[model samples]
Target chain A: MRPIVLATDYGTSGAYVGQLKSAIYTVAPGATIIDLTHELPEFNPRASAYLLASFLEYVPPESVIVGVVDPGVGSARLPVVLEGDGYTFTGPDNGLFSIVARKLSKARWSEILLSSEPASNTFHGRDIFAPVAVQLASGSTPRLAPAPAEDRAGIQWPDDLHEIVLVDHFGNGVTGIRYRPSDQERIMKVHGEKVRYAPAFHCVGPGESFWYGNSNGLIEVAVREGSAAERLDLKTGDPVGFDAAG
Target chain B: MRPIVLATDYGTSGAYVGQLKSAIYTVAPGATIIDLTHELPEFNPRASAYLLASFLEYVPPESVIVGVVDPGVGSARLPVVLEGDGYTFTGPDNGLFSIVARKLSKARWSEILLSSEPASNTFHGRDIFAPVAVQLASGSTPRLAPAPAEDRAGIQWPDDLHEIVLVDHFGNGVTGIRYRPSDQERIMKVHGEKVRYAPAFHCVGPGESFWYGNSNGLIEVAVREGSAAERLDLKTGDPVGFDAAG
Candidate 1:
């Protein structure tokens, strides 16, 4: 069975994540559901988009990746299916899919039509996206109509967002900037602190702040044996910049 | 394939939960893993025990529930398997499973004999607990020997604790007290505040503090449309009291 990956802001503590999984299991009892992360910059799809995209390479190619940071749920935003680079995507038409679409070559956008079934205005993640994800993951096509990728939200957004997209439990700040090898020579500036490059946590002294390419290929800020978030006063949506190391 | 349920203090943001899942999937590719919750009271298996026991009713009886809150990771703590009330559990031989065992009838304890395989000392959740959970869930029992249940950690702990065991994302404080219908007329006192009973959040005015039997059948303190944790200055390990409501 094709795996189903869930990315959402519903949070793990609440019933929302459980309800979403139930919807999927109700449809596909044998489905393999992987929670990429439910704590996705709550309700901020623009920031979540980058984090979700960063995890794309780690997911199985046949996986159905469901991203649901829908702040405009029950609004004018349309539910969408974007299949690209051997993976299928399902979620609201908000910029949640924009970065993933751009990252995956030959992406095709399609709108998932409502089947005259009523859904909760506040929880389309469980009501709509989950079932559609299950359908695609089960090798069944959902009701869809070809849509213009250009008209999608965040289509024109920058490829690289120079902002903190997520903060891990270890207090490491994950930026939206996809790391390149040459980028390691630059100093990262965030919260008015200059963070030099470090290959790994052990490369720096305890409590020393540094930046490095994380496993997901995103530039991340961390402090050895301490919380970079606390040390730098960093949080999601905080601006970050790069400069040539002097 | 039998399902595997995970309950831990790994928190949602870190790689621990993902690594745990990956370990199970690596061995049992078709396994269905449910993350009961990764945000258990960190390193306090005494508190996590009550919270884990409360969630047992919601899990499928055939599940292999893995509970890990091992502060003694590589220490002298024994790794064990517990079979009880139609469910199988694998984790450190800590108090994490004590409350769950007490709640279930006809519980049996078994020690999981360590193989010659090298395992990580710090991440037994992934290396030890997960693989053992998958083994039991797959109908293939691991090497085990009968152990005395009385000698296990937390065997003498209270049936119901009066301290806060968890503070969820919504800021509700879930106490270790199991709700009884007759207790409705009683007032719960915590953090120097007296809280009356309410059947549901809707029964209380916005921002009004009240206690209720939450879905998991635990007595929980909450403030409608606001944060009970913030309002009462409540947190895990905080003591609570009960009094007859006049």
Candidate 2:
């Protein structure tokens, strides 16, 4: 059976995650559904994109990744599907898959249009993306739903590499560093200091501030015995570091 | 912050889940841990063992997975640190990692001996497994606390496959088949002019019933629109199946 991973801005508190799973099961009937995360901070598309893109390589190939961080659902923003590198992506066209597509190099994409039947203004997660993903998981052809849009260029990477997109549960601000640990020291400078690689999260002194390459392989600012995001008053999507270095 | 995922048999309503997370964060400051699941049924080691073995592949390779379904925590059972395939697994060594280790093939394991350190009889999940997992995530080597045990070859897989281990939220009985669609057809057998593979949960029709094959890739008896685990007298680790083919 094909594995389908769901990445969304929907938090676990609501029925949103459950409903989406139910819908996928309704259509696919026998699909293996795994939750990448439903607790992404709401409507943070870039954050959602970064999280999905960072973890995309680890999931099994041919896995259908459905990302639903659309604040622009039912609007002019297009719902699209991109097939590339032995994987399928279904989500909004707002640059969510850009990083992933860029990493994979070649992506076959098509903009999705719902049937002439009336669609809900809100909850496109349930109405649009979930059903489409279900069908796709069940081996339905992509051409059955909608035709491809004429212009399908990839999205441009954000100019600032040091921009923080997600502050996780421990309040460590996660950045979008498209660099490996070897190249990270030179690619970006943080807080007027060259980024240092600590052996582990608490390798630095207790309560002392430190910057290191995170497990996600990005430069992150953290505290040894406290919350860096909380103490620094950082939230998701806040830009950090000098623009010239990026 | 490092991400820690918990796989435990402590049901959600209990204080075990809360305490484990609390203890983890207490020791490993600035850590971002997540619950893979806390709803595992009681101390059913086979259930917890299989669930962890099946799901660990989907998570990031370096993730620290804490499995705590120890019925023999303070008893003769060994507490172990298993290092394998970019992942670290901590739990009671009651053959929980046996299936996982076999699946990964490259798994290198060592036993965690905390006997001299003193531990609680009832709650080794908090004192032993939880703390060890936290320390591991906080950047400690496995040798910090205990020396390795020589006889690490005794771990074994569950011999019986007919028992139902977990009934999911939908009342689908999660069975040993790890039910995939390919198993759907073979699930029903012809017995003396009788036919099976009917899509009903119980001996009913026109409503949701547990047949077989669920999202987890297991042979489950699931109620389509309701809870079959509730409707029929099924609970965690209950034996279930058709006596005769068809």
In order, what are the TM-scores of chain A for the candidates?
A: 0.97, 0.85
Q: How close is candidate 2 to the true structure, as a TM-score?
A: 0.53
Which residue pairs clash in candidate 1?
Answer: none
For model 2, the DockQ equals 0.03
User: Which 10-residue span in candidate 1 chain A carries the lowest summed lDDT?
Assistant: A54-63
lDDT string for model 2 (B1-246, tens) is: 347889876554323454565456445535667788876655467766666676776777688888777645445777787877778888877766666776675676677755455333445676677778877887876553442433552354553355567778766666654654554454432121222354444555535453655444456665557776666656666665544542
Off by over 4 Å in 2: A144-154, A183-196, A242-246, B1-5, B8-65, B68-109, B112-246
* DockQ per candidate, 2 decimals: 0.12, 0.03
When summed lDDT is taken over every stretch of 10 residues in candidate 2 chain B, the lowest stretch is B187-196
| RMSD vs true structure, all candidates | 7.2, 16.9
CAPRI-wise, candidate 1 is incorrect
TM-score to native of every candidate shown: 0.62, 0.53
Q: Model 1: how far is A67 from its true place, Å?
A: 1.5
